[model samples]
Target: MMRGVMNRKVPKEILDLFEKYMDNKVRHLNRKDAIHMLRAEFGLDEEQASTMFDTFDKDKNGQMSIWEFQQFYVCMGTQPSNPHSSAQEVVQKFKDIDADGSGKIDVNEAKEGLKTLKTATGRDLDPKEIEFFIETTADDDGQIDLGAFTNLLYRLKLYNAPPPPKDVKLKNPKKD
Candidate 1:
């Protein structure tokens, strides 16, 4: 059985791996870059990728230097492990829901996504449920990005269910 370590120090091997992706151009891993790396190298899903990025982007500069990346690994090393999804699938889902290309999902877009969910599953999720999801996922800015949304879907187990092969036709629900 593998033992989990709780020390807040990144192992040298991981740091070496991070160095391979570092370059003079950015000299750091931005959120986009982190997403790509986490997907390709770590096989983390959209939510996991985003969580990893946010945890390590210490300065919130939207980017992480190699040093910062190291810190992230250290943090991960100290945390309890949880299951995650394949990065590709999660990333695709996030892209599908982003709708506005703003890198975050606003309330309106989240509502539309809920509609899509209803059409696909034939399950009418309660308005209160949707509001709770929005409230839990949204950041301080009153919007949730792909990462937070991914986490929400993950917790709901919606991320694991097989998605429809094609888009689900949506009917505008008549609001009384």
Candidate 2:
């Protein structure tokens, strides 16, 4: 995913229509409706739709307005800032990984945690990559807190980085 600009535009009329769809004067879509809209109208799968919601809902509110979604383009681009942006999931993962409840994970725990993640997500992360990440990011004491762990998967490109800008070429959109 490109950590860059999003220049695509959504018309004001569509925003208005969305507001009307919700039968609320305020320009908003609650979590369920927002996710549904992304899945139905944009044809995003459930995971993609939820990720978009997590990326777009900057305030971490259960609702979003079109403008809010647009503003987040500056932060998230078309791809999310973090794949596991859901608070509950992150917390659960932290608890599962932090074996001693020390609020930190040592290198060994991190390795085990990555294995657990691979089992859960079906994404096989390279062991060498984990070593590299630990070598670089772990504290002098050789431990990382929740914040660092949250960034790990994303900073690692979830083990698959986006193509370089020069190699990227936009394909024409298909018409229905």
Best lDDT among the predictions, by candidate number? 1
TM-score of each: 0.47, 0.42
Which 10 residues in a row give candidate 2 its minimum summed lDDT? 1-10
What shift in Å separates residue 136 of candidate 2 from its native position after superposition? 2.6
lDDT of 1 by residue, 54-148 (tens): 85677889987767765544433322232133434455566677787877788888877765554234565555556656676677777876556
Residue pairs clashing in model 2 are: none
Task: List runs of model 1 lying over 4 Å from the truth.
Answer: 1-39, 42-51, 55-85, 118-124, 158-176
Model 1 TM-score?
Answer: 0.47
- Give candidate 2's TM-score: 0.42
Tens digits of per-residue lDDT, candidate 2, 2-36, equal: 11121135444344335544643545788888888
Q: What is every candidate's alpha-carbon RMSD to the true fold?
A: 11.2, 13.4
